[model samples]
Target: MTENIAESIVEAINLTKTFHPKKMPAVVALNNISLSVRAGELTALVGPDGAGKTTFLRLICGLMDADEGSLRVGGMDVTADEQAVQDILSYMPQKFGLYEDLTIAENMTLYAELHGVPQNVRQERFARLLDMTGLAAFTGRLAGKLSGGMKQKLGLACTLVRSPKLLILDEPTVGVDPLSRRELWEILQTLTKQEHLSVLVSTAYMDEAALCQTVHVLNHGRILASGTPEELRHIADGRCCDIAPTSTMPTRMLQSHLLDDPGITDAVPVCGKVHFITRKAGGGVAFLSKYPELPKATPSEERLEDAFMILLKEDEEKRSSNIQPPSQREGDREAVVGVSKVGREGSIDCNVEGNASADTDEAIVDITVRDLVKNFGDFTAVSHTSFDVHRGEVFGLLGPNGAGKTTTFRMLCGLLPLTSGKLSVAGVDLRTARTEARRNIGYVAQKFSLYSQLTVYENLRFYGGTYGIPARELQQRIREVMEEFDLTDRADHVAGELPGGYKQRLSMAAALIHRPKILFLDEPTSGIDPLARRSFWQQIAHLSAKGTTIIITTHFMDEAEYCDRMMIQDHGEMLVLGSPSEIRERMHMPDADMNAIFIAIVEQARAELAKEGRKPA
Candidate 1:
């Protein structure tokens, strides 16, 4: 068996899946897709939303028979012997259906019975899984009480009630925190190395995909490329370069402009520089020639994302995901600045330090939270949080699962009454003008928060009217926003049926319908592809430049780099608050990227907790 470790455990030949709904065009999910997965190895399938990843997995699991081609799992024909194939694979989907009302042990027992595990071996199997997942001590806890990471771990444990030769996970770390995500990958590695279990995972994160032994990039129901990490990265070799913008140039603003160049395939902020990819190798210098005043481009190491973008860009049928820059916004919504002490590690800065600047002036306060606190029963979700957001500045709030980000957001938006605090948003005091303040605040949630059943236009009109726009002005505003957002073609499409990127666009359109001065975005770009995420940032940068203050919460550390300043909180207390440069300086990691610095800060806090003999939050 050891000698046969490299044998193919799953193989697909000319595989195809199509859906023909009544009166609708046929949706081809897979077009002659072919791939091979070796036994006891890790493989990854990565793609943008609606790229047929879920459909492909479903076909392999025998949940849906392919319209054409053939597939074999564990040497058994999946279509010809569906049950035999299902018995050898465990599939955990994006939204694993865990019985939240039941205890961990009860949930495991139920899944064991459904999977037909023998009663005699149930206890031993459960014990092993519980121990492996660090959930043994919480068997009596209800699933609903588990944290986001713990719930995902429990779902994984339940999938292993009856061990299978292959384990399939669909974006298991989508909304999980970074620490938990790292831990989960460690668990997967242990399973594959120690138990010799073959694993297949689909992810939107290139970093995660890069860790797998094999990677397959898919789009429009077709595999664009497939190979080992090194082989795939070779596609973008010598094409990647970094442009250190002049000291006067803003990083994000420079990136937004560079993305417009036809020769530049991709542009993103990396470590205070604008890292970009050229459409062709040796074109970096040529692209830089377009911007004569900019510094010379330096060759940078190639990355999986650069390769992914090149493959997607080579396809002519790819949709144009650009968001046109908007005109400057003129408003006088600034408020009184909050007072707090500065220079203390976790204390609020009572005053804006002179010489601090972003795209706009930093002295004018837009939102202020003074001694904010929120308690649900006896549990304090937010403990005396205090901070000030400046006009036109992009401020971010980052924390682990169950942290006070959402709670603080609700208070700022006037959705939830604070237990005790002083807050002001959009020049209106919550103590006096919450109703007026609502008229000037916009919010977009991480997931689809719009009316899914309504058309895009209908949703926009609804929000416009609700915000008290005149009947005549509402239509004009709606048309203007649709054109700006490039959603004219999908105006009549139902919100729920749109692809993930379009869904996010629709949500943003609805939020901006009233032209609010303050925008609150809750992990707005999560689960989307790199292309769409960059496009979204372009729009955000444009808005910030136009003098709109943005307050957001995100788990993606890279996204945090886009903020003018950000704060990281855990266990209802602020740990660090500073600009990206300030954070790197404080950590004494001049060369460390945002992701590394974030992990170090969070892990250091965890280590301190361990040293104090307390459980890490």
Candidate 2:
């Protein structure tokens, strides 16, 4: 079939969608938003969680109808010819359901048959997609057996079984690792450049959105700004700068302190320093003068993230709400809040133990993974990995998909059995006496693991009971957690229905119910927006300050900077381990950002393996 391409492949004019729950106030998901996806160009929808990016994409795909305005896909009105529009476009939702039972090739064939892709063209397309996604050799693997990144790749391939004029992806990189995320974008860019395909994608990562030719910044179901990234960047041109915090204050605490300043727009940790944006174009220097505690500002180039934050901050100021930002909430200021400490004295007694309990002042090694190894029959998941997590230290464990980081974490958390190694938490041996050791550990999983059907308060109570808290103590702890985490308003709300930020807070609250000495946060801030992330980090800062040993795994390179120490492992092997500065120095590039450093290390490792005629598992 021949093709006809319009200058604007997709267009929306004054589009709006609202949801009205039976007993609640209506939510305006999209409010008269207008945008255009230019033909043969990469377009991005940038927004925080609950910003209506998904709602807008669904409207374009005709999966749902907008309450008002017009949407045209490939110059065809979606409402009038939804099927035709869909036939010429592919919409990849956040959770693209790929049959896990089938092999990768089988899944591709199934999608091809469903799309009526004739046998003649099926092989060619499958080959092209597999090659493009770097999954050609993995065609025989079962979908369920593949890693997260591989599954996403196969999902994308299935969506493209029959090439569409326009490709719509809703946060396709949401949970994928940096390596896979980069690969996914490379595919999209090639589709736009080589095949002249128009691509529209929504992303939580500012770096990903900045790569787009056009970006529409969304907030509260409205287009806050729409322009090229350069134009958006100019929004904070003279307002952005980096300031080193005083030796006395922590970077995260400094960020929280600065956010309270009226003249400051946004403040976040960047490479262990505070990178902030001011209210006006030239307001950074003036704003710094007011805070004698802060050092002189070093001007930095603006970024799409700085611009997005400024817009969101400005918008929040115009609207009033009963719920206050976490930073402004007075209840959780102290790291050592209402939690009653559990004496680790009865737990592990080895000299190998030490994360101080909330009541203690000694900082010692909290966890030890000595020659840790995990294997699934023939596959070694974590090969002889070892690390020590000190009390009150924030340690980051990062790796690409299928890189053994998750395996290492599972072993540490005692969720999985280690094939061989000495594992210790709070000085208690993990290999034996897991039950006793678990008492001193709190784990927040990558995904929301709370009971969605239950209310927030109920979830907290359940976790407290699970942790063996007495009825009287559990009730009091629940109240304390609710107050400390600012979840009082959401206590009665169903866990599943809560927004991303609240859900995260609920998870943390549930985890903190036992007040475990070691906290394991597995990608806790994966899909949340920047504002929520800042608030989350502040909470983390508080927890760490109070002698909590935090061992976290995340896909966010920027967040790695927040770690006091971090280790990168790939293909079941340790690649590098050090603080941010130490890592940069090791790479011999003093100014290299975490992303660049990560890519370099992983690539170099893979290259060396290739030279030795071996492929990463």
Candidate 3:
């Protein structure tokens, strides 16, 4: 409200949007939301999926018309002078269309031409962007051949081919690795500071939002709050604390127990500790006394995410009490085997007795990869990689986009064959007995792979039937799963029509219809909102506690902290392996967060590769 209208880069007054599909009921995507982005400032629209962030972005870019209200961009009426508004702003959508066959340089050239950049200015601009993005060496590499992180950087370079008054990026770092994410932020920050560029970015990551000058929190088509990061942090003042577990209980268990308390607003496991927020302001000490089982609690600095969740909790409380807390779900399922205590190095000691059966007292090593090698002609995707995943352990596989993480996962899941190696999963050799190995594992692909036309219940039934479950049992199981996932209300809804969060839940439920011993998730929380991500991980933690071995790949570095052990790879080679804490200590940056550590490791690997005269693809 204090913004100067004359100096604002973008302004919206009483903006509203609604969509009417062919047969479905009209959906109001945005309610009467009013906000402004000041010139030369970075503004963030922070929200969960289906929160109208994209709708607002599209309206400002003149890609769609608002059903009501008015919007102005660069002091021009967006609806009246749409083209003029567009000419002064660049928009990078969730999926920026870079031709796969085009090289990085060619893609930039194409976008530059489309924007009508003068030929005389093209060379210098291209040089600056390439150098800034660290893609100068890969200018001739086809976009299709570039790694996921590289492709994102290229997409950004293309978008910046012609400097505009404002830049709008929608979830630009959805699947980008930690290193690339940091690089992209650096570029944007440089542009904003030196060129006086105005940017409006919609993001799911709270840390990214914290970097913005102003953040607008949206949910259910409404703006929950808007303020600077510090101002937002004040919302949770004196309410946040770190609760350390007294015993060896998993952090997830402590988190679940804390969340069950009505006074608690939110609780999440972070760095082997539970960082929790309470509803009562200035009640940290009193709250600690209520949980005597927990070790001495200490006040912690509030983060933007804490404030965001506090706002969301307040909103939810005002709305209704019908929604159940996530912790209200059924007790954890029993694990197939027991796990060993954490070692001095903070690594889980898997008491592995070779090839133990389900009835045996000794624990079994669920997955074993020894001397694994995968080849595509002269290129190696995985080289002599060896690791063991114990039953019920949360094992994380991390790397930059083209680091062969996916290829390694494919071979382990029996989806891809290894050129030469020994691979065993669930006591079955993946190379020689793929069917048996696959039967013991469930895989949820990165993308939604369920039938879009089928209803949620139908999809569940189909998956159960595919696993050859009895019709009667399958029906009951589907109902139970639907209820557990909070999908019972959406049972009749088509899978494709569901929100991103619901689609993810349905996918996981379908995959678990047969209750496989191991679950494989690839970037499961990529584009979801923070709250949805918390719920998703809670389910994962519950499943792991119940004795389900979980193997996952994710670009969100923060999620890595939850894993018992993790393996970091680059260019088909393992660079580091250990618990999150151990890896941080090895890097000798105890205070550095996961993102910093990940960037450091990848950079070190690339440096070694350059020394070896090997350029990463």
lDDT leader: 3
Tens digit of per-residue lDDT, candidate 3, span 1-617: 26788889999999999998654678889999999999998999998788899999999998899999989999899999999999999999999999999999899999998999999999999999999999998899899998888888899899999999999999999988887788899989999999999999999889999999999999878999998999999999989888664434455566666776777888886654678888886554444565667587678889999999988877876777787666544445232112344211254432211222233335457898888999999999898888777777788899988899999999989899999989999999987899978888899998999999999989998899988899999999998889879899889888888889899999899989899999999899998877888889878877877778899999988888778778888989888877776677778987566777888898988998899998754
Report model 2's TM-score to 2 decimal places. Answer: 0.91
Ordered list by lDDT, greatest first: 3, 2, 1
- Candidate 3 local lDDT, residue 221: 89
- Model 1 regions lying over 4 Å from their true place: 1-6, 21-24, 285-295, 317-362, 612-617
The residue ranges of model 2 lying beyond 4 angstroms of the native Cα positions read: 1-6, 245-250, 284-295, 321-324, 328-362, 614-616
lDDT agreement with native, every candidate: 0.81, 0.82, 0.84
**Could you tell me every candidate's TM-score relative to the true structure?**
0.91, 0.91, 0.93
- Global fold similarity of model 3 (TM-score): 0.93
lDDT string, candidate 1, 1-617, tens digits:
11232387888889988887443478888999888888888999988887899998888898889989989999999988899999999999999999999999999999999999999999899998999899999999999988888999999999999989999999998778787788788889999999999999999888898989888999889989988888899999989988775434556656756776677878898876788998788874454576688887789999988888888777523555464323222221111011111211112231223133332332567888888888888888888777788777788888877767778888888898888888989778987888988888998987788898888999999999999999999999999889878899989887777878888888888899999999999888777777678778877877776678888988777887678778887777777877777787788996777778878988788789889997633
Number of clashing pairs, model 2? Answer: 0
**Residue runs of model 3 more than 4 Å from their true location after superposition:** 284-293, 333-361, 608-617
The positional error of residue 427 in candidate 1, measured at the CA in angstroms, is 1.8
As for candidate 3, its clashing pairs are 335-547
